[model samples]
Target: MNTNVTPLTTVSRGGDAVLFAIEMRGKKLTCSITREALEAHFWLERQANEARLLRAFSDGRKRIVAIAERKARRLATEVIKLTSQDFER
Candidate 1:
């Protein structure tokens, strides 16, 4: 779609995942990646705090959003959730 993803300000804990958002073409899409995914894919610690998790997310933001966009395109959904399996080749 030739759109860029801009991360939203608010990030929250959603059970075992971190809930966040990304704006694409003026629309905000809810996105999340599991704690397990973060640990396995983003170099996050298993017992990380929220700050650490946020840092890991920020560091890997580009790759994360790219995958999310692909998932959104394939699934045609407004919500994108990433699990550890999403990272497996």
Candidate 2:
């Protein structure tokens, strides 16, 4: 499978930055931004999926959908570590 990786965004809190990965196909991508970047990535994925569904056939779109889902899940898990609530748990 052809894979392309690119840095999407990054979230910074305190002196540390949390990087979020944007994986496409088998490729993995990451970057650093502010906490708002996480939310933006989620929103961007939603919009892109909507556009993709309208333009691509169902059978050809699963890979992109899966990639987005996987990235979102991974990002959420990592973000938890940067939160104060993580220590409380």
Candidate 3:
């Protein structure tokens, strides 16, 4: 993980939504959001995102959940990529 990336939040679940943040190599890329409205899309996105994250981290470990922000709800169907290294220390 980069020393410049800062994670605004980790994993947050409430009501029917999940929220979190993505930091890579020490830089905040963007916030993410997952909710019922975009559950299907979010799931798919999460798969790809996790895959990339895994490769980037490549620690042979797995991420338990996806991170997102409430505002990202609108971009659920779009593609989003993140890595553990992005978070700042």
Candidate 4:
């Protein structure tokens, strides 16, 4: 399975997470990282608005996407949701 994670990222609809796209086997999949994960791992502030959350995600995009890709490979799912626990290792 070939996978490529794009740099394009956006805040989730509810503004509680950041969503990004992953292209795998000619299909696009959506993945997300919770605001809690951003706060704990990506230095996001409490009650941050969409802008701040997006900035945090952009700043940590590389690491975040790497983890998301790993999860996607291991779990083999169409959607990946990364929480704070995903970064524990």
- After superposition, the stretches of candidate 4 with alpha carbons farther than 4 Å from their true spots are 1-3
Q: Tell me the TM-score of model 4.
A: 0.86
- Per-model TM-score, in order, reads 0.83, 0.23, 0.26, 0.86
Give the higher-lDDT candidate: 1 or 2. 1
Error of 2 at 87 (Å): 34
Q: Lowest summed-lDDT stretch of 10 residues in model 2? A: 80-89
Clashing pairs in 2: 10-32, 10-33, 11-33, 11-34
lDDT string for model 3 (26-64, tens) is 434453333322333323334344333323222211231
lDDT score for candidate 1 against the true structure = 0.78
Candidate 2 at 21: error in angstroms?
19
Can you tell me which runs of candidate 1 are displaced by over 4 Å? Answer: 4-11
Best by TM-score: 4
Per-candidate Cα RMSD to the true structure, in Å, reads 2.1, 14.4, 11.8, 1.9
Give Cα-based local distance difference scores for all models.
0.78, 0.35, 0.33, 0.87
Measured with C-alpha atoms, the lDDT of residue 55 in candidate 3 is 34
Q: Sort by TM-score, best first: what order?
A: 4, 1, 3, 2
> Candidate 1 or 2, higher TM-score?
1
Worst 10-residue lDDT window for candidate 1 reads: 6-15
> In what order do the candidates fall by lDDT, top score first?
4, 1, 2, 3
